[model samples]
Target: MKTFKSASAFKPQRQTVVTIGTFDGVHLGHRKIINRLNQVAKTKDLDSVLLTFFPHPRMVLQQNQDLKLINTIDERIRFLSDTGLNYLVIEPFTIEFSRLKAEDYIKQYLVDQLNVAVVIVGYDHRFGRNRTANIEDLKAFAKTYHFEVEEISKQDIDDVAVSSTKIRKAITEGQIDLANTYLSKPFVLTGKVVKGRQLGKSLGYPTANLYIEENYKIIPKEGVYVVCAEIDSKPYFGMMNIGHNPTIAKDNRKSVETYFFDFEGNLYGKTLEIQLLKRIRDERKFDSLVALKAAMQKDKAFSINYIKTLQ
Candidate 1:
């Protein structure tokens, strides 16, 4: 897939069939729309172009510093790369760009810049300053731009919207399976291993302290999760904890720690990308270290059995 940082930089040699959205998570709903876009482009003998924005519009419009996303920009690119798209335009969305008049947006960006032969959009997609233009307006503008406009199925449009909300809700509620069902893939979290108190080691389950740098990347609710990661190019099954070590210390800060079953290594400073498969239980305090260790052993046994079933 070809990637362009800005619309100005995207110079398509062939006429384009285009669609635009943030396309967060690249979940099942998004895949359907992308499949339609690719199909239209293939039948019409044009290149498929996905014009997605960075710094998602909501983060800009609402000034929502606390808003989180299911996928980071890099993760989005990685997801879209597998969809057989021809062009991926990463438009830099800013306040000034948002202020562009509806007509100018179509003329300058879609029509003149992209040489778009067709535009595939959602039934309720809105654009222009303060989202003044709707799907109808896009169809109306198509006549002047000499391009065809296709609306994604109403069911698909609703599914796309709902899936995003549902996935986030599921993750926040520690419903990994539900979220994965909608996403069509396991929920993933990536981080670097850092030094920790080594409390798990004392319990015979050495844990790697994960430090996630992306503040906007959504972290699932505090719980123990059945997960897998690649270490030394080999898949490793593990149980992860995302919470404060209440049994170890009353004032312990929250941590993402994973104990890989049957694995022994020094993972300090190594990056790990963990794919969460299921939530085992919520994090809680135990009466003593002995009690906590016993509970952890049970969790490990359950996680190991679950991993075996997948194999």
Candidate 2:
């Protein structure tokens, strides 16, 4: 798929069938919409385009700094690309952009910029200043612009809403398996491996500490989880702990650390995308370093057994 960083950068070569949304997770429900978009594009012999916004609307409009998202902007782009879309446009959301009247937005973005032949949106979708317009308004605009407007049914929209809510709840509660089931893929954490205190090394399990730069990225609940990652084009299974190292440090800062089984290499400064497979247990403060080490050993044994089952 070809990606344009902004709507202005996308000079469409042909009339396009478009769908617009944040498409946060690009989970099953989002995929359903994407599938329909692709089908309609194929049937009409038009280019498939997905127009999404970055810095989410709520984040910009309400200054919602605390709103966590399922996927970082980069991750969302990657996921959208896998859906067989012909074009992907990431529009930067700003107050100025939000102020465009409904008709102006449709004319500039959908008609002039994208040359849209059809627009696929949810039944409850709204646009214009203060989001005053709805699906009916879009159909009215389509008549003026000489294009088609398709509204996804209320049932589909509800399923998408429920899936999004449940997925977020599952991740926040450490229900990785359930979240994965809903997402149709493992929950992923992408970050750079940073230097840590080397406490895990002392315990015979040196770990690569992860540092995610996107503070808005949602983190799974505090626990040790079975995870897998591809390093240097090779797959490796591991266990990850997401919690404060209470036994070693009193600072109480949460950390994401992973120890890859049967793997040896320098990972500092390397970016890794770890996929959480299952939650093993909650994180806890042990009485002593000896107790922590013993607990880690058992965790390793259980992880290896779990990995074997997968094999």
Candidate 3:
């Protein structure tokens, strides 16, 4: 999919169907919205464009914003790129840009700049200065732009609404089963495998260390997890620890170290993707290296058993 950093940079395609949002997680709810966009674009022969945001509007609009994104920019890009979108436009949210009125946004950005033929919006999606443009208001403005607005179905799972906020809350609360359903896949964390202190190697359980680039990406609480790590496009079962290595080291920095079962290679500088299956145990410091190694052995055993159950 083609990417544009801003609408100004996006040259107007002949036919375009645009859906606007931050698309933080691109979760099930977001997928439902995007599905309508794809259908609209396909039926009308319009190019599908995803107009998303960076730093989310809330971060700039609200005071003391505590933004915990479900998907980082990289993750969002990778997710949307696979949906057969023609373009994904990422607009940087700023104070000046936030003040644009609803009519002005539609007139200038969508109609004039993007040359949007049809716009598919979610049921609750609001835009423009102070988020004053509701679906009703947008419909009226759509006539002026000579474009159609579609309100996609609001998705629900088990009678509960599916949303990025709800999914994030579920993950935070260790309700990953529910989060997985909303995500439509296992929660993934992908990064480059970097070198660690060789602490795990010394314990006779060498691990591949991964560096997380986006701080906003949600990580499960500190614990041992049954993980599936992919390296060189090959999947391997692994036991992963997401926490500060307080067992044999003095440091308290959060780290993600995974020991691939019966796998060995030079992983340094290699990119890896990991899917967290389940949490086995919470993180805790051990009194001695011997104690830590024993606990890790137990963790590995639990991970294997867990994988067995999965199979």
Better of 2 and 3 by TM-score: 2
**Whole-model lDDT values for every prediction:** 0.91, 0.93, 0.81
Best by TM-score: 2
Model 2 ranges with Cα > 4 A deviation: none
Task: Report the error of model 1 at residue 160, Å.
Answer: 0.9
Which candidate leads the pack in lDDT? 2
Q: Looking at candidate 1, what is the lDDT of residue 102?
A: 96
Which pairs of residues have clashing backbones in candidate 1? Answer: none
Expressed as tens digits, the lDDT of each residue in 1-311 for candidate 2 is 99999999999888999999888889999999999999999999999999998889999999998899999998888888899999999999999999999999999999999999999999999999999999999999999889999999999999999999999999999999999999898889999999987878988999999999998999999989999999999999999999998889758788999999989999999999999998999998999998999888888899999989999
Tens-digit lDDT track of model 3 for 1-311: 99999989999758799988777667777777677788888888888899988877766778433667777788889888877788999988899889999899889888888998888876776888988888889899988768888776555322224367778887777666677787887777888899887888988889999898877678777778888976677789998888888867667777889999979779898878788888788888888878887898898888888889887
What ordering of candidates by TM-score runs from best to worst? 2, 1, 3
- Per-candidate Cα RMSD to the true structure, in Å, reads 1.4, 0.8, 2.6
User: How does model 2 fare in lDDT?
Assistant: 0.93
lDDT of 3 at 88: 92
